[model samples]
Target: MHRTPTRRQIQAKLSTMPPQRSQATAYLNAYKMMLEKERLEEELDKLEVRRHQIQQRLAILNSQTIPEGDMTHQQANTNLEDNTPKFKTLTLEY
Candidate 1:
């Protein structure tokens, strides 16, 4: 986002700066970087929320087994039992 300098900022830089740093380029760059940092932190927060939702969905699916009347119930149950423990261990670790 390109931002035009506010009146206060321009006044502060033009009239109140010390002789050695008269240009104020460093201060302006620092402000820009601060804005960029805020944008990235917001993005990270959104990604974390999505990741948590996916993990919860995985846990719910892991807890279910095929019904007893299904043709492949035995095979499905064995697969679920084998994989569910791994998911549980990972869930606890996280």
Candidate 2:
């Protein structure tokens, strides 16, 4: 099976390359890393926005008053617990 090269193997290969080629390779890798960093930053911004939206939604839900009188606080709490929205777990990968 094919496998990724180790850091030592990569360094050895780079050392054998001409200086200009080595420098070009380094520059290309740095450019790619910068692109990746920007992409990750944008993703983080989107996630933060989504988090804030969810928090606002939760606050609105919490602020809503259950009708008072007929039911005791414990009963209202139980009803809220029973009706609470269920969320599926999500797995994220880089």
Model 2 worst lDDT window (10 residues): 8-17
TM-score of 2: 0.49
- Per-candidate TM equals 0.46, 0.49
Candidate 1 per-residue C-alpha lDDT over 1-94 given as tens digits, one digit per residue, 9 for 90 to 100 = 9898766522222437454554577787678679777887999999999999999988777655334346477777888788645543334553
Query: Where's the lowest-lDDT run of ten residues in candidate 1?
Result: 9-18
lDDT of 2 by residue, 17-63 (tens): 45455787889778867977788799999999999999999887766
Clashing pairs in model 2, backbone N/Cα/C closer than 3 A: none
* lDDT (Cα atoms) of all candidates against the true structure: 0.69, 0.73
Each model's backbone clash number = 0, 0
Q: What residue runs in model 1 are displaced by over 4 Å at the alpha carbon?
A: 1-23, 65-71, 74-94
Prediction RMSDs, each to the true structure:
17.8, 18.6
